[model samples]
Target: MLWFILIPVLVILLILLISCICIVPQATAYVVEWLGVYQATWPAGLKFKVPFLMRVAKKVSLKEQVVDFKPQPVITRDNVTMQIDTVVFFQVTDAKLFTYGVERPMAAIENLTATTLRNIIGDMELDHTLTSRDIINTKITAILDQATDKWGIKVNRVEVKNIIPPAEIQDAMEKQMKAERQRRESILRAEGEKRSAILVAEGEKESAILRADAVREQRIREAQGEAQAIMEVQTALADSIKLLNEAAPTDKVLAIKSLEALAKVADGKATKLIIPSDMQNLAGMVASIKEMVTDDSAKK
Candidate 1:
């Protein structure tokens, strides 16, 4: 009966001891509270707590986390209403502060983000808001980081996910863009036509110049050929005159040769002729020969 009573007590003690021991995992933190008051933060590995006196209040993750907030209505400086949503990346730095700093930290961050975004957009026009996304993101991240410092939440980055302008404004922008693209296309087409015309004109001008050069060359060749022919004729004439001088012809032979040259000139298409004084005498002598031939025929 004594052994049975001791065995039951040993088993109960063992159960209690196992329940009091806590093992914190990696990238995790445990906030311990003693008698409902803040005590110590337990890190990874084996940890011990006073039995029935201390408890794990909250388990905080040290890893980075992301929160995507819904779209909120905002008005720009130009009084243009638009809807914008954001995403925030954060990590827990101090587990104790994170546990006790604020109630509902995620909700607090969302509200703060919406208010800050409105303030920023209120100072800018619609055009600036649409174009300066990086500037807006940086400004919001800086503000949130400073505000959440006491809460042990480090805001690493903030991003504007989407911005939806009014439907009318979007349609107008699209039409304007279309017109601008058409204008650019027209200008490019006009430039291309102008360049083509210039090329054709240049080609025609070059062709004209080449044709003129070819004509000039042909005329020059013809003139040179004519001059060569004249030179050859003059040389042949000179050779003939030299042979005649060497032959030493008598005056009668010279007169006969002159008569032959006069006969050749008379055969031409010319209507006028100038007779030499010696030619008249030669003609009279030819007429006497004709009369002598006639008298001899009669006598025969």
Candidate 2:
């Protein structure tokens, strides 16, 4: 009977001991509450709590987290309505403050983000809002970081995810883009045509220069050929005169040769003939002819 009673009590104690001990994981924190009031925050590793009076109020993760909020309709300063969504990156700094400072922290953050975004967009015009996303994100992050400091949340960065304008505005933007692209294409084509014309003009100029050079060279070659022919004829005549002088022919022999040249000239169909005064002696001409005939007959 005593052993049975001791065993039951020992098992109950073991169960209580196990229930009182808590093991916190890495990058995790446990907020403890005693008697429905905040007590202490337990960090990673082993922790002990008084059973039946102390309990973990909340488990906070210390890692950075991202939250993407839904799109909210906002009116710009120019009274243009647009939808904008945002994303927030944050980390828990103090586990105790995070647990007790705010109720439903994620929902509170979402509401805060929407309100802050509306205020920022309301101060800017539609065109500015569309173009200044980075500026808006920086402003929002600074505001949120300051506001959430007491809640033990650090706002690392904020991003504007998407912005949607009216359908009429989108159509107008597309038409403007198309006109701009066409203008650029026209300018490029004109530049290309101008470059092509320049190249053609240069090529024609070069061809004209080459043709002029060729013509000049051909004329020079023809003149040189004519000059060489004249020189050759003069040299042949000089050689014939030299051979005749070396033969030492008498005056009568010279007169015979001159007569032969005159006879060749008279063979042409000329209307007139002029004779030299020396050939006016008919008897001498006849005697020379008879002598020429006698010598020819003797040789035969």
Candidate 3:
């Protein structure tokens, strides 16, 4: 009878021992409360609780989490309306403050992100906002890091997902881009035409200059040839006249030359002939008649 009662007591003690101690997964932490009051946080692996007095209030995940804030309509300094969507990457650094400092860290972060984004975009014009998105992201991160310092939420990174302009504004932007592209194309075509025209003109100018130089060289060569020809003919005529003037009247050299000339004029075939009526005409006729008479005497 005493052994049976002792076994029941031992079983109760074993159940209490196993129930108080809990095994938490790695990268996870649990908030523990003692007698309905906040006590301490339990880390990964094995931890002990005060049996029924202490309870696991909440299980807090310590890993990095991404929170996307709701789209906030922000007006730029230039009064352009746009919808901004943002995503914040964060992690819990201190479990105690993360659980106790803020009731809803995600909501708080979203609200803070919206407000900061609005403030940042509000200070920039529409054109500046599109261009300086990185600057705005940095500013948001700076503000969030400072604001969430006490909450034990580390803002790892802040990114602006999309900045949506209105429908009419988007159409206007597209038209403007298309117009700019067309203007650039027109300018490029005009520049190409201008270059082509310049090259063609340069080629024509070079061709004309080459033709002019060739003509000048040809005319100079022709003039030189004509002058040389005239000089040679005049030299031959002067030599013939000197030979005739130097000949002796009784030398018979002129008579022999005259006979040779007359023989050449009547040699081979001479169906019809004309002689100039000048001072040498009668002498030529006399030489011809003498050559014929001399030939007849030689034959006899």
Winning model by TM-score: 2
Task: Please identify which of the two predictions, 1 or 3, would achieve the higher lDDT against the true structure.
Answer: 1
For residue 103, give model 1's deviation from the true position in Å.
Answer: 0.5
Name the lDDT of candidate 3. 0.87
Ranking by lDDT: 1, 2, 3
lDDT of 1 at 82: 96
Q: For candidate 3, give the lDDT of residue 209.
A: 100
lDDT of 2 by residue, 117-147 (tens): 9999999999999899999999999999999
Q: How much lDDT does each candidate structure score? A: 0.94, 0.93, 0.87
Q: What does candidate 3 score in Cα RMSD to the true structure? A: 8.2
Stretches of candidate 2 off by over 4 Å are: 1-12, 195-300
For residues 1-300, write the lDDT of model 1, one tens digit per residue: 899999999999999899888999999999999999989999999998888899999999999999999999999999999999999999999999999999999999999999999999999999999999999999999999999999999999999999999999989989999999999999999999999999999999999999999999999999999999999999998998899999997655566677678888899888998678786778865665566668789999
- Per residue, candidate 3 scores C-alpha lDDT tens digits across 1-300 of 999999999999999999988999999888888897889888999888888799998788889999887678999998889999999999998887888899888889998999999899988998898888799889999999999989988998899988988889889999999999999999999999999999999999999999999999999999999999999999998998787788744434555666567678878487975554574865765676677679889999
Q: TM-score, each model? A: 0.63, 0.66, 0.60
> In the order shown, what is each candidate's alpha-carbon RMSD?
7.7, 6.0, 8.2
Clashes of each: 0, 0, 0
RMSD to the native, candidate 2? 6.0
